[model samples]
Target chain A: MTQANPATLHIISKSPTHQQLYRDIANALLDDDAILFIEGGVYACCGTEATALLAATNNIYALSIDAQSRGLANTTPAAITLISDQQFVELCCQYHKTLSWF
Target chain B: MIFSILIYASSNSSQTEQSALRFTRAVLQQGHSIHRVFFYGESVNACSNLIVTPRDETNITEQWLTLASAAKLDMVVCISAAVRRGILDGAEAKRHNKSSANLSEGFQLSGLGQLADAIIMSDRTITFGN
Candidate 1:
């Protein structure tokens, strides 16, 4: 509801050290879009290169369930906002389109 | 809502195929329409018939075929990835001079354009796997 065209990018993997997944995600995201990080993907926001690429991304969200379980609730970068499971569904609804990267 | 699925992991290794199967079932149960299922990377291996499965284990290929047939779903495997992994359809097998094809039933081989088309036509693109 906040933008004319909202799309949610969901990341769910660690991408190992190769980080091809990170490069792929950086190339895939569009402007004014929000990213939902869950599972091992919460690790993505902590990297230095990831922070640089995330500058172009409008909103970055991490699932609180995964964040809490991974003990990353308080450790994530300031730009990443943790949201509830219900909010994850709400994000999918609000965006009308979601691209999951796993 | 209309949904499109992307599978990137192999049936032999990753949990993507099983997860995709469960998600598709849930989507259908929820009364949503699936525009297409696009198989990329190692996931294209699901279209091969040469894989051996133990009687006790869940056959991921069969699960996808069953869903595709029952729902009349449009399942597409990326041609670029398929060729690299030796997942050839009858035509591709003939073109490549292979003795036979290994593509399982209920799946089609197409280009990345089909994936782009799926994304453009569907409401959401749900990916499973790394």
Candidate 2:
């Protein structure tokens, strides 16, 4: 049987204004890795820049309350899954490790 | 699974600290366990007892204390970060000849080695910053 690769959950809390940060995360991501956007990072779920970032990983998530508070809840693309606080904890458990990008 | 959290955001400046606290609460609620919560960078300021939050705002430090007390969490503030930011414990205050110690109860001051240990001992090490 082929063993599945361990996945990482990347938690990002900075806005896309930090252009290099996105590139750094992209370079570091593996095929099985996922991204979770929280705080100011939820802003990435909107606008044109969201497309490129969304394409980077098959699994992209954003904190629902955070996106709601920032008025991006409805505007967030359908490609990104909006999760709750409880789900966030579950995601951490589902992954091998979590790397925060701020 | 065992988890360790590294907090680097300033409690006063960013929402990330509160976010970390909420995440911890959820972790406990889900029947998961936490090995430690390591406060580094500007987050060490959250250990200061003298920080008076305005009546309108939620006191993040007090919130952490309550949770830590209930959860029996090992909350460690980075010694170098705390001392540099004026968040001194009794021993540190005496050693440095400061007038008073303001480190909050339920939080201990330690070195980055504790962080290294947490990373090794826990199943996952998560960072909350900025």
Candidate 3:
């Protein structure tokens, strides 16, 4: 069973090839946990390298600014939700805890 | 409420240090306390007095030092992370047979357990990274 309060995962690295971190997140996530991609991390929602984790992950989000900056605003798959900075702050409080991976 | 802050990036790269600094200031302005500030990964580099900032640029390390002094906060740099990056305190310098110690005046080198304790004891633990 997962802990009563599971930490939400936040990834900020831009590199899509850090397969180990993605694998770690996949292995650690629980049903109720959320995953957020900010800065260069928005790349996690695209390409074959990301397919497995994206399929396993639920409640995935990407910062709107980062997505727009990278021209991913329109092309990012529906699996990822674009959130504003205000929403980012709200999400921080909404989750019991936050673990940032870079 | 008491807050624990975790910083994982070096002052040289990313805006992690700035974000953590602003958040810490706001936390104090809101009348809250910071139980601990744990510097892990590249963030351990921020504790060194060895850095030289440009004349026109804001000294992020000095900003932290001033804020930490004013707030009387407990700041720790992870020993494992620090030594790996060449941050040594007096004792560590002696043990490692280093020429000198460069640990900033207000910071100390500790262990990962301090991070665990900060997480357990503080009301919230927020991280700032790349």
lDDT winner:
2
Where does model 3 exceed 4 Å of error? Answer: A1-7, A10-14, A45-58, A64-89, B14-33, B55-58, B69-72, B79-100, B126-130
lDDT of 1 by residue, A1-102 (tens): 343555655555563354787677777777777787765677765657566447768688887766787777888878888886556545665785676766
Off by over 4 Å in 1: A1-9, A15-91, A99-102
- Residue pairs clashing, model 2: none
Q: Compute each candidate's TM-score over C-alphas.
A: 0.67, 0.95, 0.67
Cα DockQ of the candidate 3 complex: 0.28
Reference-based TM-score, model 2: 0.95
Better of 1 and 2 by lDDT: 2
True contacts recovered per prediction? 0.41, 1.00, 0.38
lDDT (Cα, tens digit) per residue for candidate 1, span B21-53: 766777776677889999999888878899888
Please give the range of 10 consecutive residues that has the lowest summed lDDT in model 2 chain B: B9-18
Report the C-alpha lDDT of model 2 over A1-102, residue by residue, as the tens digit.
112338889999988888899888888888678999999999999776656667778999999999999999899888899999999988888887788998
Model 1, chain B only, scores a TM-score of: 0.95
* Most accurate candidate by DockQ: 2
Residue B63 deviation, candidate 3, in Å? 3.5
Model-by-model lDDT, in order?
0.76, 0.89, 0.79
Model 2 has a clash total of 0
Residue B101 lDDT in candidate 2: 98
